[model samples]
Every structure is written in C-alpha cells, then in structure tokens.
Target: YSLSVAYQPSDDLNLYGRYATGYRSGGFNGEMFGSNPFFEEKVNSWELGVKSNLLDGRVRANASVYGYVWEDIQTAKIETDNGTATSGLVNAGEADRWGGELELMGAVSDSMVVGFNYSYINGDFEEFPDLCGVDPTIPCLDGTANAVRSNSPGNQYSAFTDITLARLGNGEISAFINVAYSEATPENALWSNLVANDVFPRENPAQIMDQRTLVDAQIAWRDIAIGDGMLTVTLWGKNLLDDDYPNYSINFGALNFITEQYGDPATYGVDFTYEF
Candidate 1:
C-alpha cells in the first residue's frame, strides 16, 4: 500500500511526501534445506523531497530524505553440517534503515552542461540469531548475533558533464564524460572459509575491501543524411581508466583472496543507427 502528497509552493518549486508498505515472500534454499522455507518479510517506509529551478530555469536541483523499517528480514548463511558444506536461508530478525539523496544540474553555457548527485544509506540489525553452530545442544541465541547488516554501503556519489564540441553540415557532434564512486562494505556476515571449517564465526569490521571509482566517456555525431534517411554514430568506452578493485574478499588466516566483480575490462566501441 502507498500514499503520497504534493504541493507547489511557487511556480518554480515543488514539494512532496509519501508513505508506503511492501513485502517479500519467503523462499527455500535448495542448496542447504531443500524444502524448509523462511518467513516472509515486510517493510514500512516514508519519504519527503523537494525540487526547484534556479538561475532563471538554467539550473535545477532536487533532494530527498527517507527512512524504513523491516520485519522478519531474510538472511542467508553457509555452514558445515556434519562435515558437509551447506547454504540456507532464515528469518534473521528485524532491521532499521535510513538514507538521503541529492542531485543538481546546470546549463552553464549554451553548449555545455554539468550534473552532480550524491546518496547515503545506513542499516542496522535489530535481532539475528545464529541457527548454524557446532554444538547441537546449545541454544541459538548464545552469543550468536550480529550488529551490522550485510551488503549495506553507507555512501555513494557521482558526477557527469556533456559538451557540444562542434557542428557539421545538418549534424552536430557532442562529447560527454561521467565518473562514479562507492563506499566499501562487508561482503558477507561471516567469512565463508571459517564457517566451512565448522567454527562459530563473527564478522570483522576491520576486514573490509577498499572503495571503488570508475570513469567513462563517449563521443557521438548525429543527424547525418543517408539518402532520405538520417544516420547517427557513437564511440564510447566504459571503465576507461581500468581501475582495479575487489568486489568480494576474504581472509583465511594464511590465505587472502579477492574477486574482481567490477564488470568487464575497459572497452571501446562504435555504433550506427539509421532512421527513415
């Protein structure tokens, strides 16, 4: 269910607020428990935001703040059960999350434009018990809980700019550049290798991967004539600087491992499109 309200304070400014509720159905983890299903999860959220035009419509800005709470959050874990590795999903407990975002764009000149955006989020575990342990006689709540939520990054920011380089006969050529960055976060609640060894585990806050930054750019020419049709061509490259960062990492006493899930390597390509 959802509800929203909006107000136009001025001809160039707008404000809004919203409230909503959502849910996710439970599912089973075939890797560890073929038929046992976790409980469904639900969330309630609220948001308030504002949008405005400044500098006589040449500049635009928007910002918003939001918060939410989750009940019966489903979390997954990998463990060793009787010397066999297994993965399973469980209703870990509850969590509270909050965040905000900001964006600004400006037409600095007739031929160039710039934009900036930033966002931040924070999540906390209310109650989560370890269901997988070495001692079968001990209760699940005996020193088996977590404070931090997995995969929750605290902050991120990005910026982009586009410039019209030149104009050709009945066509125009433009170039653009964009850059993005993300804060580091925990890859998982427990280190995989330790859990696989049948030992009770706790996530180490100090053991974190480094942050990431990526850059990309593109140039294009459009509205060229091909007989009675129009043609456009574009040249582009992503992750242009080839910055290397670990998307996943683990420390296993003697061995350190990292997986580069930063996506494909730096690549450049040209595209052609025609319209009649």
Candidate 2:
C-alpha cells in the first residue's frame, strides 16, 4: 500500500511526501536440506522531497530523503556441510535504512545542457543473530554477530552533460558524456571473518568489493530525412577509462584460496535507428 501528496507553493517550486508498505512472501531454501523455511518479510517506508526551477526554468534542482524499517529481512549466504558448499537464503532479522539524493541540471546555452547527481544510503542490521565467520567449516548456527547489508553502497555520484555540436544538412550533431563513481561495499551479508578479533575482526577482504569509477559517452547525428522517415546514427563507448575492479569473489579459507570476477573493460560500438 502507498499514499502520496504534493503541493505547489509557487509557479516554480513544489513539495511532496509519501508513505508506503511492502511485503515479501516466505520461501524455502532449496539448496539446504532439512532447513526450516524462512518467514515472510515486511517493511514500512517514507520520503519527503522538493523540486524547484530557477532562472525562468533554465536551471532546475531537486532533492529528497527517505527511510525505512525492515522486519524479518531475507538474506543470502553460502551453506557448507561435509566440505561442500551451497548457496541459500535465510531470514536475518531486522534492519534500518535511510538515504537521500540531490539532482541539479542547467541550460548553459540554447545548445548545451549540464547536469549532476549525488546519492547516499546506509543500512544497519538491528537484530541479526546468525552471522558467520570466514571459515567455511564454521556454520552460521555457531555464532551471533551483526554484519553490514550486502551490496549496499553508502555513496554514489555522477555527472553528465549533453551538447549540440553543430547543424549539418537537415540534421543535428550532438554528444553526451557521463561519469559515475560508487563506494566500496560488502559482497556478503553474513560472513565477516569475525572469529579472530570478535570485537573488531577484519571483514573477509576478498568479499569486500573495491570502489570504482566509470565513464561512458556517445556522439550522434539525427533527423536526416530518409524516404519520409528519420534516421539516426550514434557511436558510443562504455567504461571509457578502462577501470580494473573486482565485482565478485568467493573465499575458500580452508583451501587457502579465493576466486574473483572483474568488471568489464572499455568497449565501443555504433548504433543505427530509423523512424517512419
């Protein structure tokens, strides 16, 4: 269920708020035999935000903040038995999350526009009691510790711009560029290698993903008339900087080894489209 309200205090400004409830059905962990089925999960969330236009709509800005309380949160983990490992999910208890975002865009000229966006988020386990250590031989049932939510980055930032470069025979040439960054975060929610220092044991370094920055861009020519239709051609590139970063990993401590998968390298391509 959800409820939302909005108000416009002026011709160029507006404010809004929302409240919502969410639910997820319970399910069994097919990978682990004799494991009890997890219970359903629920959450309550809310948000408040505002939007504004300045300089006669040439510049625009928006911001928002939100929070949520989650119960019986379902989390994924690796289950080991008799030297074998299987992936499965479990209900890890409660969590509290909050975040906000800011966006700004401006028309610097009739032919060019620039924009920037930033977002931040945080999540903490409020009642997780089944955390596990890096030792695959040790099961979660053997310990009680809190761990950060998996894949939840605390901050992200991006900036992008679009520009009209020129006017050619019945067509327009334009270009766009975007740069983005993400903060490092844990890849697994339950395994933190806490057996060593229980108080402040280091996380499984192999399971913590590294922060990364990526850039993508494209240039295109559009609106060339072709048999009563329009044609567009574009050239694009992704991960322009060719950043090297590990996106996923698994730690097999008993074997004294770990495995990792990396993000993609720089790549380029061309696209063609026609409309009638």
Candidate 3:
C-alpha cells in the first residue's frame, strides 16, 4: 500500500510527502543442501520532498529525504564444510535506512546547460543477531553479531553539462559530458562486519568494493539532410579517465580466497543513425 500527497504553493514550487508498505515472498535456498527456506521480507517507508522551478523556468531544483524500516531482510552468504563451499540465502534480520538526495539543473544560456546531483545513505542492522564472522567454521545461525547492510554506499555524486558547440549546414553540433563517483560498499555479512569493526584486523581488501570515479562524454552532429532522410553521427567514450576499481566480488571464507570483477576500461565508439 502507498499514499502520497503534493501541494503546490506557487506556480513554480511544490511540496510532497509519501508513505508506503512493501512485501517480498519467501523462497527456499536451493544451493545449500537441506537448507531451510528463508521467510519473506517487508518494508515501511516514508519520504518528504520539494520541487521548484526558479529564475523564470531557466533553472530547476529538487530535493528529498527518506527513511525505511526493513524487516526479515533476505541476504545471501557462503557456507563451507570440509573446504567445499555453497552459497544460500537467509533472512538476516531487520534494518533501518535513511537517505537524502539533491538535484539541480539550470540553463546558463540559450546554448548551454549544466546539472548536478548528489545522494547520501546510511543503513544499519536493527536486529541482526545471527551474523557470521571471519571464521567459516562458526555457523551463521549460532553466531550473534551486528553487521552493516550489504551493498549500501554512504555517498554518491554526479555532474554533467550539455553544450551546443556550433551550427553547421542544415545541422547542429552538440556535446555532452558526465562524471560520476561512488563510495566503497560491502559485499556481504562478513564484509559488512569488517566495516563495523565487529571483526578486527582486515583480512583482505578484495572483500570490499572500491570507491571510484568515472567520466563519459559524447558529441554528435544531427539533422543532416541525406537523400530522403535525416542523418545523425555521434562519437562517444566511456570511463574516459580509465579509472580502475572493483565493481563486484565474492568471498569464499574457508576456501581462503576472494574473487573480484572490475569495471570496464576506457572505451570509445561511433554511432550512426538515419530517420526518414
């Protein structure tokens, strides 16, 4: 169930609030032999926000703050017996999360526009008692420790600009560029514990996703008349700075190894399109 309300105080400004309830069905853990089924999860959320158009509609800005109560959160973990590892899902427990975001965009002139966005989030286990530590021999169900929520980054930011570079014969040349940054995140229970200092002496850095900044840009010429059609040509690049960072990882505790996958390297390409 969900409810939301919005009030427009002026032609250019609005305020809103919302509340929602969510549910997820339970499922069995197929990977762990004879493993019990994990129960469903639930969440209750609330949010308040505002939106505005400023400077005669040349600029726009929006901001929001939100909180959530998550119950019976389903999480996955690896279990090892006699050096053989198996992964399965479990209902780790409840958690609380709060976050906020801000977005701003404005037209500096008739041919140029710029925008920025930022978000922050903090989440912690509210009732996670059965959390495993670095030792694989200790059964997760038998352990009692608080852990941070997995895959939750504390902060992120991005900025971009669009510019009309020139006017060509029957066409316009434009360019766009964007840069994004993400804070490091934990992968699972053990990794989360390391971040919370529940487990001392960091075992391996591979268990945590690394923070990184990436840049991407593209330029295009559009509306060129070509025999019975309009053509567009574009050149683009991604990860322009070639920043290296781990995007995903898996920790095999008893196996004493962690596997990681990295973000893509710098890439460049060209695109062509035609419209009749």
Q: In lDDT terms, which candidate is top?
A: 2
- Tens-digit lDDT string for candidate 1 (100-211): 9999999989999999999999877766665434555644432124446557678888999999999888789999999999888876654333344443443333345557
How displaced is residue 192 in candidate 3, in Å?
11
Cα deviation of 226, candidate 3, in Å: 2.0
TM-score of each: 0.86, 0.88, 0.88
- In terms of TM-score, how similar is model 1 to the real structure? 0.86
For model 2, the stretches where C-alpha displacement exceeds 4 angstroms are 131-145, 192-206
* Decreasing TM-score order of the candidates: 3, 2, 1
lDDT of 1: 0.76
Per-model C-alpha lDDT, please?
Answer: 0.76, 0.82, 0.81
Looking at candidate 3, what is the lDDT of residue 253? Answer: 48
Identify the superior model by TM-score, candidate 1 or candidate 3: 3
The clash tally of candidate 1 reads: 0
Residues 1-276, candidate 2, lDDT per residue (tens digit)? 999999999999999999999999998867544566888999999999999999999999999999999998887655455556566667878889999999999999999999999999987788875554556565554223446667878999999999999999889999999999999987777653333323332334338888999999999999999998999999999999999988988775543567789999999999999999
Model 3: number of backbone collisions: 0
